[model samples]
Target: MTQKEPAGSVAAVAGDKSSLLTMDFREKSWIKVQKKDGSVIAEYIGKPGEQRQLEINEPVTIIVGFAPGVTMAFRGNPVDLAPNTVNSVARISLK
Candidate 1:
């Protein structure tokens, strides 16, 4: 059996700001945006700034295959990618 590599995770703190996620892809990259329930919202290898801003009423989880050229912010705050910078991939929970 082939085992998948473990992914890094970061949680978004509950705050007063609206549940808005802003994604700016500076390069072509693969990304999966989903709700916490595992329902996928968007998944694709998109061009720069392809998915500008997504408004989800609930929390979401995003798995980014390439982190360097992607910019993601939730609730007006930037999601920290430093924790998984070396891994080249990040699994973030915007909950």
Candidate 2:
């Protein structure tokens, strides 16, 4: 019997002042973005091989569910996350 594997790892990429943030994943998962005050900024479900863009103005925390073949990039730059990671969180500051 083949055991069903859990979601894969999470990756992140941040954008600069003149660019928009982008995230890409290979599996279905939930994404959440929050501010320093714990207020949610953005939340949504992502599809496989999906790419999302966001415009942030302050420091925020990003939370993503682990899914197989997940990857992320910010402003066209790749952000590295732990391999085979579970639910992950990334803090970003746009100053």
Candidate 3:
């Protein structure tokens, strides 16, 4: 039987600052995205960020496999947050 990966809240930590105007972090979450046959296609860390500041250790819902982005509360609508040099870790859930 194929083993299914556990799904839950993943925490991403800030790695390094991208630029003077932008911040960046390293994805600490191990996310495996597959197509069919459970074959791993793309694997990356799913983290959320905004502007040039990412509220590290903050709990935010990261929607994966939709677009090259993340989700955030923007004016009562789900917005896609793209990865940028200024992008930083928004939240880190408690254990």
Candidate 4:
């Protein structure tokens, strides 16, 4: 017979498991990451055409301030952000 793990016993592991998110800032803008409790985890101001890389964790939120010409990509996938508006990327849970 095969053994089965206990219920709720398998803990979530974050061991070297991360996704690369690259932001190509075409204009000046503020980028930040927050938790569910409204706590800021990471924040920064990106320059024009600046390339930024972030190793993202699970169950977090990403907030981007209004800025035109700013674009983002996760795992080489383009992320669409509205212009001149506050954008929030939430519920980013990675297994």
lDDT of each: 0.74, 0.62, 0.33, 0.61
Give the per-residue lDDT digits (tens) of candidate 3, residues 2-31. Answer: 544358533333442211112222333333
Of candidate 4, the 10-residue stretch with the lowest lDDT total is 86-95
**Per-residue lDDT over 2-90 for candidate 4, one digit per residue giving the tens place of the 0 to 100 score:** 55546853333334323567778887878877766778768888889788877655455776764455677764566656532544332
Clashes of 1: 0
TM values, all candidates: 0.68, 0.63, 0.22, 0.63
Which sections of candidate 3 miss by over 4 Å? 1-30, 50-95
Backbone atom clashes (below 3 Å) for every candidate: 0, 5, 7, 0
Report how far residue 52 has shifted in candidate 4, in Å: 1.0
How many angstroms is residue 45 displaced in model 4 relative to the true structure, after the best TM-score fit?
A: 0.6
> Which candidate achieves the best lDDT against the true structure?
1
* Candidate 1 residue-wise lDDT at 95: 59
lDDT value, residue 79 of candidate 3: 38
Better of 1 and 2 by TM-score: 1
Model 4 scores what on Cα lDDT? 0.61
Cα RMSD for predicted model 1:
9.7
**Most accurate candidate by TM-score:** 1
